[model samples]
Target: MKLYQRLHPGVNLGPTDPENHEEAEEKIFGFWIFLMSDLVLFSVLFATYAAMSIQGVALGPSPKDIFDLSPVFLETMVLLASSFTFGLAILELKYRKNQGRLALWLTLTGLLGALFVGLELNDYRILLTEHGAAPQTSGFLSAYYLLTGTHALHVSVAIIWLIVLAVQLATLGPVGPVKLRLMRLALFWHMLDIIWIGIFTFVYLYGVVL
Candidate 1:
């Protein structure tokens, strides 16, 4: 047995039907391509945010004026925890094959994700209503909303997807198709965590410091 397979015995599921394995590999490869495209999209948004951050804040609230670090920090931790729970869910699905435990982890992950989105929207409300940092106010605020809003949108969709997958798991158990879908969801959820880290560092940290 391979080292990883030995370490996590049930995960590898060695010597599957050849045709099914090929199809699964193809779908995963396609998902990787989609993720690469998403990376490009985020790269453009980050560059725009950087360029605009300095240009139009003189007449309005700066990032420092509107960013509440406490909430942002809390949401970041929440998202990180969700990712960890999702990892546990995968372990349960692959190793233990325990339906109830997997569903519990998935539910917890979805709740954490929803909380992150809620906190983010609250941040937006504070900026727009209290500090007058609406997208129409300045380039900085516009770019800020666009970047963060796009990420928030992604998380919202992910939460919906999680719900659907949980339903599937409950109905179908850990069959091949469900397992494949869960693998894709895992990649996606973890990807959002990474993107959030970048946002916290680049937008929030740099915005406050510089």
Candidate 2:
């Protein structure tokens, strides 16, 4: 908590032992490298989507036909809320050290994530069954499925990771390594939130308006 201190690659994270801090710096730097790679991957998908969205329908259902803004907007709000709850959980651990409250927040975050996935799946169901817009139906649908599905897959993985970490925190009591892991997970979760914002804007919102 020193002035001009940097803690665990997050905002307002508490300091750790020197040994752990040094190790965390290395690991978090590596994590940054991984995130950069992931950014490149998403960039490619976005480019692909942009290329296909215009002419890809080819007699299939267009974005206007398949996209329902209401559920997507709700999903966006839920995910943004989950990010806020996760931030609360981290700050709780940093300052309050209340394991129960921290776990509660984690649970809430996971539930929100699950809700997001469910909502997306429902949208998929409607697109496929009601709108007859499966991925194989057109290039636009294919690209849309690939991009959004990849993101949803990432969220599912993160939720599983969250459960694992919660168990570790309960059993391991937030030791140095565990806190470092939590820091990495926090970065990953926040990154997903950012990516979803892109999807919301570029895919869903643009699909509707443009």
Candidate 3:
């Protein structure tokens, strides 16, 4: 209820009893802490990636060998575009007073996101089968799987969340609680964009140059 009060405009769900905002503020603080914890997890995984990158497998394909810059770059563009679209969606929700625009943009975001996932999965399958670059084939492949696979898992979860949020908008019409939750989820989606940019630059681009 505190979240509902703090975030929603003119919809103070907080208690008139003068004890509600404190609880909401605490929940917001806790959620931020949780977000930080997740960031730490990603940082550790990135460190592991850096350590294992140089230690390639003896007979297996390395990142440069299996990674096609064109496709990965294209996937990056798609995700980036989706992030921008989601931002627009949030803006429309906040002020334009139109749930339809928000929902339309979000649906577009989901489609773009799903397309990127499809391309990645296709690339992975090709690398494993035609290129013979399975995870067990090399340390590089193992790290590749660990890093990209984790990102893919997060993308899948976000897609599911997007679908659920779409339904909420469809039913609830971006009224109160759902609007704030959607904003948070949009932020989460954009956060993934930040991580993907890091992966693209460091993991893919740097690997290609190396």
lDDT of 3 at 47: 83
For each candidate, give its TM-score against the true structure. Answer: 0.90, 0.93, 0.85
**Best first by lDDT, ranked:** 2, 1, 3
Q: What is the C-alpha local distance difference test score of each model?
A: 0.84, 0.87, 0.78
Candidate 2: tens digits of C-alpha lDDT, residues 85-164: 99998788766888999999999999999999999999999888888888998899899999999999999999999999
Error of 1 at 186 (Å): 0.7
TM-score of 3: 0.85
Whose lDDT is higher: candidate 1's or candidate 3's? 1
Query: lDDT (0-100) at residue 174 of candidate 3?
Result: 64
List model 1 lDDT by residue over 1-210, tens digit each. Answer: 543344223434334423344455667778879988998999999999988888866577788777777889999999999999999998887668778898899999999999999999999888877887889888888899999999999999999999998888888878888887887888889999999999999999988887
Which residue segments of model 3 deviate by more than 4 Å? 1-29
Top model number, TM-score = 2
- Ranking of candidates on TM-score, top first: 2, 1, 3
Backbone atom clashes (below 3 Å) for every candidate: 0, 0, 0
